[model samples]
Target: MLGLCMGLAGVVWAELPAPSFTLAWTHTIEKIRWEEDYRVTPSGLLLGEARIKGSGAGMEIPDGAELREGAWHYQSHLPPLQPLRLGRTPEAGDYQLCIDQRCRPLGDWVGPPQADRPALELWSCETGSGAG
Candidate 1:
Protein backbone atom coordinates (compact mmCIF):
# COMPACT_ATOMS: atom_id res chain seq x y z
CA MET A 1 0.00 0.00 0.00
CA LEU A 2 2.80 2.40 0.93
CA GLY A 3 4.67 1.65 -2.31
CA LEU A 4 1.54 2.22 -4.33
CA CYS A 5 0.95 5.50 -2.52
CA MET A 6 4.49 6.68 -3.27
CA GLY A 7 4.07 5.74 -6.88
CA LEU A 8 0.91 7.75 -7.08
CA ALA A 9 2.67 10.72 -5.58
CA GLY A 10 5.44 10.47 -8.09
CA VAL A 11 2.99 10.38 -10.90
CA VAL A 12 1.32 13.44 -9.50
CA TRP A 13 4.62 15.30 -9.67
CA ALA A 14 5.49 14.00 -13.11
CA GLU A 15 6.48 16.71 -15.53
CA LEU A 16 3.92 17.84 -18.01
CA PRO A 17 4.48 17.24 -21.70
CA ALA A 18 6.45 20.10 -23.18
CA PRO A 19 4.31 22.38 -25.31
CA SER A 20 5.69 21.96 -28.81
CA PHE A 21 5.28 24.78 -31.27
CA THR A 22 6.95 26.96 -33.87
CA LEU A 23 7.14 30.74 -33.67
CA ALA A 24 7.80 33.16 -36.50
CA TRP A 25 7.93 36.83 -37.44
CA THR A 26 9.34 38.85 -40.31
CA HIS A 27 9.93 42.29 -41.85
CA THR A 28 9.98 42.65 -45.61
CA ILE A 29 11.62 46.09 -45.79
CA GLU A 30 14.62 44.81 -43.84
CA LYS A 31 14.49 41.59 -45.82
CA ILE A 32 14.92 39.65 -42.60
CA ARG A 33 12.95 36.82 -41.05
CA TRP A 34 13.02 34.87 -37.77
CA GLU A 35 11.53 31.57 -36.72
CA GLU A 36 11.99 29.57 -33.53
CA ASP A 37 11.22 26.01 -32.56
CA TYR A 38 10.40 25.57 -28.90
CA ARG A 39 9.11 23.18 -26.29
CA VAL A 40 7.75 24.49 -23.05
CA THR A 41 7.67 22.18 -20.10
CA PRO A 42 4.70 22.18 -17.79
CA SER A 43 6.92 24.01 -15.34
CA GLY A 44 6.81 26.85 -17.85
CA LEU A 45 10.39 26.46 -19.00
CA LEU A 46 10.83 27.03 -22.73
CA LEU A 47 13.68 25.43 -24.66
CA GLY A 48 14.25 26.16 -28.34
CA GLU A 49 16.50 27.56 -31.06
CA ALA A 50 15.93 29.94 -33.92
CA ARG A 51 17.03 30.78 -37.46
CA ILE A 52 17.27 34.02 -39.40
CA LYS A 53 16.96 34.46 -43.16
CA GLY A 54 17.56 37.40 -45.45
CA SER A 55 17.09 38.21 -49.08
CA GLY A 56 18.31 41.61 -50.31
CA ALA A 57 20.68 42.95 -47.63
CA GLY A 58 21.41 39.61 -45.93
CA MET A 59 20.19 38.33 -42.59
CA GLU A 60 21.56 40.09 -39.55
CA ILE A 61 20.93 38.46 -36.15
CA PRO A 62 22.08 40.61 -33.29
CA ASP A 63 23.93 39.18 -30.29
CA GLY A 64 21.34 40.27 -27.73
CA ALA A 65 18.52 38.92 -29.87
CA GLU A 66 16.11 37.01 -27.66
CA LEU A 67 12.53 35.92 -27.20
CA ARG A 68 11.24 37.78 -24.22
CA GLU A 69 7.56 37.67 -23.26
CA GLY A 70 6.96 36.04 -26.64
CA ALA A 71 8.54 38.73 -28.81
CA TRP A 72 11.76 38.34 -30.74
CA HIS A 73 13.91 41.37 -30.17
CA TYR A 74 16.92 41.74 -32.45
CA GLN A 75 18.46 44.32 -30.17
CA SER A 76 22.15 43.94 -30.61
CA HIS A 77 23.87 44.51 -33.96
CA LEU A 78 20.42 45.27 -35.39
CA PRO A 79 17.60 47.70 -34.87
CA PRO A 80 15.36 47.40 -31.80
CA LEU A 81 12.01 45.55 -32.07
CA GLN A 82 12.45 45.01 -35.78
CA PRO A 83 11.72 41.67 -37.43
CA LEU A 84 14.77 39.40 -37.82
CA ARG A 85 13.83 37.94 -41.19
CA LEU A 86 12.68 34.62 -39.82
CA GLY A 87 13.19 31.57 -42.05
CA ARG A 88 14.35 27.96 -42.21
CA THR A 89 17.50 26.26 -43.51
CA PRO A 90 17.22 22.47 -43.46
CA GLU A 91 20.87 22.15 -44.44
CA ALA A 92 22.14 23.93 -41.33
CA GLY A 93 20.51 21.27 -39.14
CA ASP A 94 20.77 22.26 -35.46
CA TYR A 95 23.22 25.10 -36.11
CA GLN A 96 23.18 28.51 -37.74
CA LEU A 97 25.61 28.58 -40.67
CA CYS A 98 27.03 32.01 -40.04
CA ILE A 99 29.52 33.56 -42.42
CA ASP A 100 31.10 36.96 -41.78
CA GLN A 101 29.12 37.06 -38.52
CA ARG A 102 25.95 36.30 -40.52
CA CYS A 103 24.40 33.22 -42.03
CA ARG A 104 21.38 32.27 -44.04
CA PRO A 105 18.44 31.01 -42.01
CA LEU A 106 18.97 27.60 -40.45
CA GLY A 107 16.60 24.92 -39.10
CA ASP A 108 13.31 26.51 -38.11
CA TRP A 109 10.12 24.47 -38.27
CA VAL A 110 7.50 26.33 -40.25
CA GLY A 111 3.73 25.96 -41.01
CA PRO A 112 3.14 22.93 -38.79
CA PRO A 113 5.08 20.12 -37.19
CA GLN A 114 3.59 16.84 -38.34
CA ALA A 115 0.15 15.49 -39.00
CA ASP A 116 0.24 14.14 -35.45
CA ARG A 117 1.63 17.43 -34.15
CA PRO A 118 0.29 18.79 -30.89
CA ALA A 119 -1.95 21.78 -30.87
CA LEU A 120 -0.11 25.12 -30.88
CA GLU A 121 -0.79 28.22 -28.88
CA LEU A 122 0.86 31.32 -30.23
CA TRP A 123 1.72 34.11 -27.81
CA SER A 124 2.16 37.54 -29.22
CA CYS A 125 3.49 40.48 -27.25
CA GLU A 126 2.11 42.87 -29.81
CA THR A 127 -1.36 41.52 -29.07
CA GLY A 128 -0.58 40.82 -25.42
CA SER A 129 -2.48 37.57 -25.71
CA GLY A 130 -2.22 33.98 -26.81
CA ALA A 131 -4.00 32.46 -29.80
CA GLY A 132 -4.40 28.94 -31.10
Candidate 2:
Protein backbone atom coordinates (compact mmCIF):
# COMPACT_ATOMS: atom_id res chain seq x y z
CA MET A 1 0.00 0.00 0.00
CA LEU A 2 1.08 3.55 -0.68
CA GLY A 3 0.22 6.57 1.41
CA LEU A 4 -0.32 10.03 -0.01
CA CYS A 5 0.07 13.13 2.05
CA MET A 6 -1.93 16.30 1.53
CA GLY A 7 -0.62 19.31 3.31
CA LEU A 8 -0.05 23.03 3.41
CA ALA A 9 3.34 24.54 4.12
CA GLY A 10 4.92 21.38 5.47
CA VAL A 11 2.04 20.71 7.82
CA VAL A 12 0.09 17.63 6.83
CA TRP A 13 -3.66 17.80 7.00
CA ALA A 14 -4.54 14.31 5.75
CA GLU A 15 -3.47 11.05 4.20
CA LEU A 16 -5.17 8.97 1.57
CA PRO A 17 -4.84 5.42 0.34
CA ALA A 18 -2.93 5.93 -2.84
CA PRO A 19 -1.82 3.12 -5.05
CA SER A 20 -2.74 5.31 -7.99
CA PHE A 21 -5.01 8.30 -8.42
CA THR A 22 -6.12 11.03 -10.77
CA LEU A 23 -6.19 14.76 -10.23
CA ALA A 24 -8.52 16.73 -12.43
CA TRP A 25 -9.69 20.29 -12.78
CA THR A 26 -10.93 22.87 -15.22
CA HIS A 27 -8.29 25.30 -16.34
CA THR A 28 -9.00 28.63 -14.68
CA ILE A 29 -8.01 30.57 -17.78
CA GLU A 30 -9.21 28.31 -20.59
CA LYS A 31 -12.09 26.61 -18.78
CA ILE A 32 -11.14 23.34 -20.38
CA ARG A 33 -11.08 20.12 -18.40
CA TRP A 34 -7.73 18.49 -17.74
CA GLU A 35 -6.86 15.23 -16.02
CA GLU A 36 -3.60 13.67 -14.97
CA ASP A 37 -3.07 10.09 -13.81
CA TYR A 38 -0.42 9.46 -11.23
CA ARG A 39 1.08 6.38 -9.67
CA VAL A 40 2.46 6.49 -6.16
CA THR A 41 5.94 5.14 -5.72
CA PRO A 42 8.44 4.87 -2.95
CA SER A 43 10.49 7.76 -4.28
CA GLY A 44 7.74 10.07 -5.45
CA LEU A 45 4.65 10.39 -7.59
CA LEU A 46 4.91 9.26 -11.20
CA LEU A 47 2.86 11.11 -13.79
CA GLY A 48 1.68 8.35 -16.07
CA GLU A 49 -0.84 9.94 -18.39
CA ALA A 50 -2.64 13.17 -19.11
CA ARG A 51 -5.66 14.20 -21.09
CA ILE A 52 -7.37 17.46 -21.95
CA LYS A 53 -10.83 18.09 -23.30
CA GLY A 54 -9.52 20.87 -25.55
CA SER A 55 -6.51 22.99 -26.16
CA GLY A 56 -6.07 26.67 -25.42
CA ALA A 57 -3.55 29.08 -23.92
CA GLY A 58 -0.84 27.12 -22.05
CA MET A 59 -2.59 23.91 -23.11
CA GLU A 60 -0.56 23.01 -26.12
CA ILE A 61 -0.86 19.45 -27.33
CA PRO A 62 2.43 17.87 -26.51
CA ASP A 63 4.47 15.94 -29.01
CA GLY A 64 3.18 12.36 -29.42
CA ALA A 65 -0.25 13.29 -28.13
CA GLU A 66 -3.19 11.71 -29.91
CA LEU A 67 -6.72 12.89 -30.22
CA ARG A 68 -9.27 10.38 -28.99
CA GLU A 69 -12.93 10.74 -28.19
CA GLY A 70 -12.85 14.53 -28.32
CA ALA A 71 -9.83 14.75 -26.06
CA TRP A 72 -6.07 14.82 -26.43
CA HIS A 73 -4.17 12.14 -24.55
CA TYR A 74 -0.51 11.45 -23.97
CA GLN A 75 1.93 9.70 -21.69
CA SER A 76 4.14 11.79 -19.44
CA HIS A 77 7.88 11.18 -19.63
CA LEU A 78 8.93 13.52 -16.86
CA PRO A 79 10.80 12.35 -13.81
CA PRO A 80 8.95 11.46 -10.65
CA LEU A 81 7.73 14.56 -8.81
CA GLN A 82 8.71 14.63 -5.18
CA PRO A 83 5.98 17.08 -4.31
CA LEU A 84 3.21 18.29 -6.55
CA ARG A 85 1.97 21.76 -5.73
CA LEU A 86 -1.66 22.64 -6.31
CA GLY A 87 -2.73 26.26 -5.93
CA ARG A 88 -6.15 26.66 -4.43
CA THR A 89 -8.47 29.65 -4.55
CA PRO A 90 -12.14 29.98 -3.78
CA GLU A 91 -12.83 31.38 -7.21
CA ALA A 92 -11.11 28.67 -9.23
CA GLY A 93 -13.32 25.82 -8.04
CA ASP A 94 -12.22 22.65 -6.28
CA TYR A 95 -9.82 20.14 -7.72
CA GLN A 96 -11.27 16.65 -8.10
CA LEU A 97 -9.12 13.92 -6.65
CA CYS A 98 -10.10 10.49 -7.88
CA ILE A 99 -9.12 7.24 -6.29
CA ASP A 100 -10.59 3.78 -6.77
CA GLN A 101 -12.86 5.21 -9.44
CA ARG A 102 -14.49 7.53 -6.92
CA CYS A 103 -14.02 11.29 -7.15
CA ARG A 104 -14.31 13.94 -4.51
CA PRO A 105 -13.32 17.52 -3.94
CA LEU A 106 -9.75 17.78 -2.77
CA GLY A 107 -10.94 19.65 0.27
CA ASP A 108 -12.65 16.45 1.36
CA TRP A 109 -9.22 15.16 2.08
CA VAL A 110 -7.26 18.25 3.10
CA GLY A 111 -9.94 20.33 4.71
CA PRO A 112 -11.08 23.75 3.45
CA PRO A 113 -8.65 26.10 1.83
CA GLN A 114 -7.04 28.65 4.07
CA ALA A 115 -6.75 32.23 2.87
CA ASP A 116 -3.23 32.45 4.23
CA ARG A 117 -2.12 29.06 2.92
CA PRO A 118 -2.90 29.18 -0.74
CA ALA A 119 -1.22 26.01 -1.95
CA LEU A 120 -1.79 22.34 -1.23
CA GLU A 121 1.19 20.04 -1.48
CA LEU A 122 0.97 16.37 -2.42
CA TRP A 123 3.66 13.74 -2.28
CA SER A 124 4.27 10.12 -1.42
CA CYS A 125 4.23 9.90 2.38
CA GLU A 126 7.35 7.78 2.23
CA THR A 127 9.29 10.79 1.02
CA GLY A 128 8.67 13.17 3.86
CA SER A 129 7.69 13.51 7.49
CA GLY A 130 4.57 15.49 8.38
CA ALA A 131 1.92 15.05 11.04
CA GLY A 132 -1.54 14.13 9.90
Candidate 3:
Protein backbone atom coordinates (compact mmCIF):
# COMPACT_ATOMS: atom_id res chain seq x y z
CA MET A 1 0.00 0.00 0.00
CA LEU A 2 2.81 2.42 0.81
CA GLY A 3 4.57 1.74 -2.52
CA LEU A 4 1.32 2.22 -4.47
CA CYS A 5 0.63 5.52 -2.76
CA MET A 6 4.14 6.80 -3.46
CA GLY A 7 3.89 5.77 -7.10
CA LEU A 8 0.58 7.56 -7.47
CA ALA A 9 1.98 10.70 -5.94
CA GLY A 10 4.98 10.61 -8.24
CA VAL A 11 2.77 10.21 -11.27
CA VAL A 12 0.62 13.15 -10.23
CA TRP A 13 3.65 15.31 -9.64
CA ALA A 14 5.10 14.43 -13.00
CA GLU A 15 1.80 15.16 -14.77
CA LEU A 16 1.52 18.64 -13.33
CA PRO A 17 1.84 21.27 -16.08
CA ALA A 18 4.33 24.12 -16.16
CA PRO A 19 3.30 27.74 -15.67
CA SER A 20 2.42 29.72 -18.84
CA PHE A 21 3.58 33.17 -20.09
CA THR A 22 1.28 35.95 -21.28
CA LEU A 23 1.53 38.85 -23.70
CA ALA A 24 1.84 42.36 -22.35
CA TRP A 25 0.33 44.07 -25.40
CA THR A 26 0.34 44.18 -29.22
CA HIS A 27 0.98 46.78 -31.91
CA THR A 28 -0.71 46.96 -35.31
CA ILE A 29 1.26 48.37 -38.22
CA GLU A 30 0.20 49.44 -41.68
CA LYS A 31 3.27 48.00 -43.40
CA ILE A 32 6.90 46.80 -42.96
CA ARG A 33 8.74 47.54 -46.15
CA TRP A 34 12.37 48.55 -46.57
CA GLU A 35 14.96 47.53 -43.96
CA GLU A 36 13.34 46.03 -40.91
CA ASP A 37 14.13 48.19 -37.91
CA TYR A 38 14.35 47.03 -34.31
CA ARG A 39 15.27 48.31 -30.84
CA VAL A 40 18.91 48.83 -29.88
CA THR A 41 20.87 49.19 -26.67
CA PRO A 42 23.48 51.76 -25.70
CA SER A 43 26.26 49.47 -26.85
CA GLY A 44 24.46 48.93 -30.17
CA LEU A 45 22.99 45.46 -29.83
CA LEU A 46 19.72 43.71 -30.40
CA LEU A 47 17.23 43.33 -27.58
CA GLY A 48 15.67 40.27 -29.19
CA GLU A 49 15.44 38.56 -32.51
CA ALA A 50 12.71 39.80 -34.85
CA ARG A 51 11.15 37.00 -36.82
CA ILE A 52 8.99 38.09 -39.76
CA LYS A 53 6.79 35.71 -41.74
CA GLY A 54 3.98 35.99 -44.29
CA SER A 55 3.17 35.90 -48.02
CA GLY A 56 3.41 38.89 -50.27
CA ALA A 57 4.55 40.17 -53.68
CA GLY A 58 8.20 39.83 -54.69
CA MET A 59 9.01 38.16 -51.40
CA GLU A 60 11.41 35.34 -52.24
CA ILE A 61 12.03 32.84 -49.43
CA PRO A 62 14.25 29.96 -50.52
CA ASP A 63 13.41 26.42 -49.52
CA GLY A 64 14.72 25.34 -46.10
CA ALA A 65 15.63 28.94 -45.43
CA GLU A 66 13.91 28.74 -42.09
CA LEU A 67 12.05 26.30 -39.89
CA ARG A 68 8.88 27.25 -41.80
CA GLU A 69 8.93 28.20 -45.52
CA GLY A 70 5.79 30.05 -46.36
CA ALA A 71 5.56 32.70 -49.08
CA TRP A 72 8.06 34.71 -47.04
CA HIS A 73 10.23 34.48 -43.92
CA TYR A 74 12.62 37.22 -42.84
CA GLN A 75 14.14 37.05 -39.40
CA SER A 76 16.83 39.13 -37.69
CA HIS A 77 18.20 39.52 -34.19
CA LEU A 78 17.27 43.00 -33.01
CA PRO A 79 18.99 45.19 -30.48
CA PRO A 80 17.52 45.86 -27.06
CA LEU A 81 14.30 47.92 -26.90
CA GLN A 82 15.86 51.08 -25.49
CA PRO A 83 17.10 53.09 -28.47
CA LEU A 84 14.75 51.81 -31.17
CA ARG A 85 12.66 53.89 -33.52
CA LEU A 86 10.24 53.35 -36.39
CA GLY A 87 10.79 55.99 -39.05
CA ARG A 88 10.32 59.45 -37.51
CA THR A 89 8.88 58.10 -34.28
CA PRO A 90 8.45 54.81 -32.49
CA GLU A 91 5.65 52.48 -33.60
CA ALA A 92 4.62 49.81 -31.14
CA GLY A 93 1.94 48.46 -28.84
CA ASP A 94 1.98 46.52 -25.57
CA TYR A 95 -0.04 43.37 -24.96
CA GLN A 96 0.37 40.50 -22.55
CA LEU A 97 2.73 37.84 -23.97
CA CYS A 98 3.00 34.20 -22.99
CA ILE A 99 4.53 30.98 -24.28
CA ASP A 100 3.43 27.35 -24.13
CA GLN A 101 6.14 24.93 -23.11
CA ARG A 102 5.41 22.65 -26.05
CA CYS A 103 4.31 25.01 -28.80
CA ARG A 104 6.68 27.01 -31.02
CA PRO A 105 5.08 29.35 -33.55
CA LEU A 106 7.65 29.41 -36.37
CA GLY A 107 9.21 26.11 -35.41
CA ASP A 108 6.05 24.08 -34.91
CA TRP A 109 3.43 25.65 -37.17
CA VAL A 110 3.18 26.00 -40.96
CA GLY A 111 3.82 29.35 -42.63
CA PRO A 112 1.09 31.78 -43.50
CA PRO A 113 -1.19 31.22 -46.49
CA GLN A 114 -0.30 32.25 -50.05
CA ALA A 115 -3.20 34.42 -51.07
CA ASP A 116 -4.84 37.41 -49.36
CA ARG A 117 -2.14 37.78 -46.77
CA PRO A 118 -2.69 41.03 -44.99
CA ALA A 119 0.06 43.53 -44.18
CA LEU A 120 2.32 42.37 -41.35
CA GLU A 121 1.71 43.54 -37.80
CA LEU A 122 4.07 43.50 -34.79
CA TRP A 123 2.64 42.04 -31.58
CA SER A 124 4.26 42.68 -28.17
CA CYS A 125 3.14 41.13 -24.94
CA GLU A 126 4.11 40.20 -21.40
CA THR A 127 4.12 36.71 -19.93
CA GLY A 128 0.90 35.01 -18.71
CA SER A 129 -2.47 36.60 -19.54
CA GLY A 130 -4.30 34.24 -21.91
CA ALA A 131 -3.40 36.56 -24.86
CA GLY A 132 -1.73 35.66 -28.14
lDDT score, candidate 3, position 126: 22
RMSD of each: 14.8, 2.4, 16.5
Superposition error at 97 for model 2 (Å): 0.2
TM-score quality measure for candidate 3:
0.24
Score candidate 2 by TM-score against the native: 0.90
* Cα-based lDDT for every prediction: 0.33, 0.85, 0.27
Model 1 misplaced regions, further than 4 Å: 1-18, 55-59, 62-132
Error of 2 at 87 (Å): 0.8
TM-score of each: 0.29, 0.90, 0.24
Better of 2 and 3 by TM-score: 2
lDDT of 2 at 50: 95
| Each model's backbone clash number | 7, 0, 36
The residue-by-residue lDDT of candidate 3 on 22-107, one tens digit each, is 21222244332222333322343233322335424554444444534332334554433322222111233222222442322221
lDDT of 2 by residue, 38-103 (tens): 998888889998999988899898999999999999999989887899898887888999998788
Off by over 4 Å in 3: 1-42, 45-48, 57-64, 69-82, 87-132
lDDT score for candidate 2 against the true structure: 0.85
